[model samples]
Target: MREKLQHVAGRVWLYPHDPDPEAIGACVGVIADDRGSVLIDAGNSPAHAREVQQAIAAEGLPAPRWLVYTHHHWDHTWGAAAWPDVEVVAHSSAVDLLTAEAERPWSHQYLRDQVALDPKLGPSFRARALAVPDFGELAIVLPHRTFDDALTLPTGVELRHVGGSHAPDSIVALDPGSSVLLVGDCYYPPPFHLRTDDDGPDLAMARRLLAEKHAVSVDAHSAPRSGS
Candidate 1:
């Protein structure tokens, strides 16, 4: 099912999905007063993006005005291309990775690995996965404005670039008034085989950081876990 969480103050809707048995990620939606909205972390494929779009339509929310990628990973950013003429935002390092991927030839082997890792997807999903061009041809639009440590959105949301734990340029968003923090993939549930040759969490650091907030903490995962 399409899991959801609501932020009343910001009118933000968080959609969570367990794409794999051990892994979960979320796509965020922020509704503007009467204007369009913004999306955070498009899912792993255009199909996922379309699913998000359909959900928004069902809810009568405004179409996403922008797409914000939490980090530079396939599961989070691969569906970005589905949005038309929308501004996409990500860290500089993320842009570098997306750019690099766009130029290389499509790798069927990599697609196979993705399928093997997430067997929940069907044959059509695999087709779209393998069809993605390298980063160069992927139309990876860079962030119009880049931030080093901290940045605030027009809606009075403050996002801070916490030091990299999951990837070289990961950032966390904190809503001081509401005490809600959006941490990307820094602290995934332990069940997933997180430790890998290249990417995973710095468990000790993540644990410490996770302790700071006494309020709700959201990740690109299934649900918002308590920070306390």
Candidate 2:
């Protein structure tokens, strides 16, 4: 799949999700500001993350000074090590989940074993993890800062925790200037790997926010849309 960044708003750019490849990573957002840009989520792997960095440079935007996680899902947080210089941020609930994942050993054999033993670790996930040449290099860097409810950055972006069935730590980043909301999978249905019948929650919070103040809503795994 071609890796490219799509401008969604005046100051918001999105690396959209491509479904051509199975187990592909989610969409990532870049909020550009004179103060210093902010990243929505790390890519699924180091290689994937590097693509984002390359795209940013190609567009002549400043490298992100901060990295924010929408949730603690592997696809969203695994590439964290790629941006070591940035101060990472996430919902307070994500720390423990990320810590647990970080404690686990990452290796081809371990991933295969998990897939065999745990229904949640399906084949697609294994394939995605294996895409990286060296599992030993995979790392999940925990957030350097966290918030329970909402926080605003100096760049004028707002981070808000709006937990839903998709994830208890689900959050969104709102760039008021652009009227764009970067909603991490907070509105997506549960993954098939989870093997749960529950589809998930509605995007009421996201809808309300957009309806109240924004013009565009960017989903982690879908193209940016207008009118909520």
Best by TM-score: 2
- Over the full model, what C-alpha lDDT does candidate 1 score relative to the true structure? 0.61
Off by over 4 Å in 1: 1-10, 22-26, 29-35, 107-141, 188-200
* Backbone clashes counted, model 2: 0
Candidate 2's displacement at residue 189, Å, is 2.6
Pairs of colliding residues, candidate 2: none
lDDT of each: 0.61, 0.82
**Clash counts for all predictions:** 9, 0
lDDT of 2 by residue, 184-227 (tens): 88877666676366565466765565666568888777778887
Candidate 1 structure quality by residue, lDDT tens digits, 43-150: 766666667777777777777766666676666776777777667766666767677766655455656676588764445345445435443334444565556767
Error of 1 at 108 (Å): 3.3
Question: Model 2: runs farther than 4 Å from truth?
Answer: 201-210
TM-scores across all candidates?
0.72, 0.92
Tell me, by lDDT, which candidate is best.
2
| TM-score of model 1 vs. true structure | 0.72
